[model samples]
Target: MTKITIPLDNPTLDDVARHADVSPATVSRFMNNPSIVSERSKRKIEESIRELSYVPHAAARTLASKKSRMIGVVVPSLDDALFGHFLELFHSHISTEGYTTVVASSGYSSDEEHIQITQMVSHGVDALLLVGLARDESVYSLLNKKKIPYAITWATDDLGEHSCVGFSNHDAAVKITEYLMDLGHRQFAMISGTLKGNDRASNRLQGVRDALARRELSLPDELVIEGPIGIEHGQKAFKLLMSRSPRPTVIVCGADPLAYGAIFESKVLGVEVPQDVSITGFDDTWLAAHLTPSLTTLRTPQQQMSLLSAEYLIAKLKGEDVDVPPTLGVDLVVRESCSSPA
Candidate 1:
């Protein structure tokens, strides 16, 4: 076997073109699709590449293919486990197909979401994975203009006509509430994530209201408190809810981190969970099951979402047809945190 000599310096496509005595565009075509180039040029370019050890620029080659093979994911926040789980599963799935995920946190801001999306598009992401379906019309318009494919995960919109995976936040909230109501809970309060510019949080609040309305019960303006996703905010919201005379028999949280805050705050206040009051949360995070009183929460189909999202985008890239489920389902995981009010 003959050993090959190594080049001291990196050789670019132009160097290969020069060595091959061909145009740079011809070298590019040879690199991207050898079938498009003449046999003589292809043979010369291959020989030149071997002699110079010329490496094709990945970005330039991808540009020629019109596929970055990168999927952009923008979530409300990267700090939350709900999004973390979704991403973990998503990465595991999407990576198998030779796609890389570039993640960004919107910090629960619509404007930030738009900015992240635009930046991803500018960077040549082949597709996008967003958390929810509700965003500015301009965002959708921009995506349309760019001809970029996208999938919405975690929340579904019936009228949006967008590719979506995951369950209905509104329906899940209703189920959680109905579960508590079935447990003989009447007085209710909610600690929800910030509603503005977030369809997931707003739909959860509306779900609770709809559930309450079904039983001739109502969530007064004071019964619901909106704050950002965090344990600290949940604690503050829980404290405020508990301070009122005759504490609400049940408190439903929009996400598990918020529930964690509520439960910890309840312990601080010397309130017995499910005895003095019941608590339920969304996004059945790992911490939920390990809490002092394990949380009753919704087990979002994160793996399913991840799988479907990857499949959907891969199909789009392959020019294959795929059937996206109208709406995915979620499981209501009952635990020690909720029971009939005494």
Candidate 2:
């Protein structure tokens, strides 16, 4: 038996040039300005590079360009589908432009976010992706001092001084609330994730109130329940809501997970959804559409915003002057979970 040894040096431009019978400069031109290379020569170089399993040295490229090909992303948790989807979309777009993402979870703590940002800055991430504009002053100070490019995501504000790539949380929530109100849901109860540290949650609650205020309806102190972001939190909130003498005809959840919990709890309590009480949620995750009775939710363009955020940050890091910062729209998805007052 004859054993053959395979070389592991991997292919480089010189190797590609040798395989294609061209100079190294031709291969470089093919990579940088393909338009200048002859079509036949371009095909030969690409084919050779592929056949040789050639991977360009990223460190060499970074050394030549003085750019760290990493984007830092900070989020509260990886458990949430919205954030998970955002991570997937964000990384996919950035990777196409020769950048990688470094993600850190802040554990729903503002202080933790500050620490994460500081660490990411120390690691020299080219840009940062933050969920909302609710970080501590130190985080902003660090970014400004380092001149690190960043874009606030998920929640949009009209008065955002920094570049943002998201839809208006307040507006989206208000639109959803108005749709429910139009269904004649007057006695309202809310199952909201804790709003102490999340601007997105706070803005959503405010949007609900803003719409309710239009009809002189508001979330009563007893009717409003706050808990951590989860279905169990929604279950607890639902239990609380049901304890009222004249229970609310509708329940508004800050997120789809919480809404699912509320719906699940309602089922356990033998309460019929939308027949006895209508429920609505924000951030239409994939499961929202597949639930027993499809959830009426706010169709937030989370993936679009995440992709655009990565694109804009990568562009800024590459010194490209973008004429417009990316911003996506959110729409209210009316479904079976919500209906006219029972």
Candidate 3:
């Protein structure tokens, strides 16, 4: 194949059209309304642009279309695999639709989230994706005042006015707790993520409590360990739980990372999983199935939720009618890590 390189200094739409064997008007249509462009033409235009290394002028595109073609996303943190996987899928889906994504981490702080939202708005993002609905009311008001379309992920509330695409954390947790109860495991200890300003974490903890209450059982204050989400925290929390006079038969972790840490610590302490004490975790991450005992976890529909959230935001930006976002479901993945009380 002959190498073709267009001048980087001044590559124009006409040049792109000539290289792609299409008219200038066709090139403009492909740039602005890619949805209407045929697959053949789309491929040609894309290949030509890549070959020539053509860069579109953002200001010109914005002026012509009256859109920034950018989406802002704010999450608790990107340190964990769960959030990282969701972001990867979400970004991939939106990029195909010609929209760019900008992400910010709140470090699990609502105040920091407010600041990030303000910065994204100042940068002129056309839409936004918030991880959860636990943000302050002022954050919503800010988006409303700016007329920016947005959606919430990680948890769902149909009764709420805001658009959200996620499953019920409370219900999922309840299901897992009931599963443990069915296995004849009575004593329960929970290693939970910090619940402050995090509806997902709080709801999960509540679900466990509700399930335990129905069984005439309660998670004693001494058995509940709430801390930052990390492997080190999980290890320390597991050690504390095991040190109790009457240790729990099974431990439920709020997230997979914590569960992984607990499992590792159990081995380090010469305690066998499911033989010594069973364990469960939420959000079945990639490593969940590969662990020594294979973690029992709830598989949250992160990929589907993220894809739907991106689609909702894009539709709203394009002035299309969008129905109420659907509430996704979670699946209980029974693995080797969980079993009847030893």
Give the number of the best model, judged by TM-score.
3
Tell me which residue pairs clash in candidate 3. Answer: none
**Which ten residues in a row are the worst by lDDT in model 1?**
1-10
Ranking by TM-score: 3, 2, 1
| lDDT, candidates in the order shown | 0.86, 0.83, 0.89
Lowest lDDT 10-residue stretch of candidate 3: 1-10
Model 3: residue 69 alpha-carbon error in angstroms: 0.7
Cα lDDT, model 2, residue 262:
90
Q: Give the per-residue lDDT of model 2 (tens digit) for 250-338.
A: 99898999999999999899988999999998888888998877899999887778777877887787688974354678888889998
What RMSD value applies to candidate 3?
A: 2.3
State the local distance difference test value for candidate 3: 0.89
Regions more than 4 Å wrong, model 3: 1-8
TM-score, cand. 2 vs. native: 0.87
